[model samples]
Target: MGIILMFMLLASVTPFLFLQLKKTVFALVQTILLVGMWLYFFEVVFQAAPAAFSIPWIMFYASLFVAEVGWVMFIIRLIKTSSTVQESFQ
Candidate 1:
């Protein structure tokens, strides 16, 4: 329960946390939604406990997958915009 709540909070806040990357907000939100849904499925559908679960791999893969996708999209958008701005100066 608590674990799920914490993840939910993180999902909600992650987008705002990276406000510097305005274009990334959408990607961050998508990732958050995916994470949140997966967590809910595990907690509700599978009824997993928040005990000392020794599943580091699950956490690592899930978190990194979402974050990696978001980061890649963010970098792409940032580069595209910066290039456009540079081109405008010429």
Candidate 2:
């Protein structure tokens, strides 16, 4: 689905973009919180659970959400390590 594709693209590129743009940790935290909240909102929106599609495409999107969480955590760790290394070299 188009939404899944877009999410995949975002999940793949956002961390690198954040690093390149030297975005603040606060921004990343805000993004993660916003996404988690949005997902929770949608789960509530579909309170009855999703309908059974012939091919269950939604599963991929759900998995992508999990992957994105990992990506966010990885980015946070990357930021911490970079900052520590920079401080050490200074």
Candidate 3:
């Protein structure tokens, strides 16, 4: 659970880094981290935690979902900006 949370925190920051770097590689890595962390939480933490932890679990999942959506939007914007820059250079 601690490891999952740590990774989640790390994953949250990566999208901002991706936006600043504007590299496809960073975007790819961010995508992988986002998906992987969620899978880890669902597969590992969800299964291990007892019923008493339900509320915290829900909160964590909701936060992660929100972060994921934000990152996806940022990635889309980054791609659009990159394309615009490329078109201008041409």
Candidate 4:
């Protein structure tokens, strides 16, 4: 009980703080990822909602791993959008 509450609080608060500091696309993505990951943890321990062998269940589990992919894609996109030199020709 206590452990679940502690994790829940941490999961919700950290992303909220980031969003407060920076209301941007990255902040929104982070909020979704963190909350989704928290839901995954809750389901893992409590067996709530979706059954063990279902797509939603798999998605809940996937949230645990998607953080890396999200960040990597964000970084790659950021690089792609950045200018190569000090100024643009167009």
Q: Considering every candidate listed, which one attains the maximal TM-score?
A: 3
- Candidate 3 whole-model C-alpha lDDT, 0 to 1: 0.63
Instruction: Give lDDT tens digits, candidate 3, residues 1-90.
Output: 586577488667766666665666666655665664565467654576434346545545555665566567677887999999999999
Candidate 3 residues lying further than 4 Å off, grouped into runs, are: 1-3, 11-53
Q: What lDDT tens digits, residue by residue, belong to model 1 across residues 46-69? A: 675443433433543465455555
Write model 4 residue lDDT over 1-90, tens digit each, in one string.
Answer: 686566445545544444544546655665666666666667667975666756545544454344444445555655666755324755
What is every candidate's alpha-carbon RMSD to the true fold?
A: 7.8, 10.1, 8.8, 7.7
lDDT against the true structure, per candidate, is 0.57, 0.55, 0.63, 0.55
Model 1: worst 10 consecutive residues (lDDT sum) = 51-60
Estimated TM-score for each candidate: 0.42, 0.42, 0.49, 0.38
Deviation in angstroms for 58 in model 2?
5.1
Indicate the residue-level lDDT of 48 in model 3: 68
Query: Candidate 2: where are CA atoms >4 Å away?
Result: 1-3, 9-58
- Per-model tally of clashing residue pairs: 0, 0, 0, 0
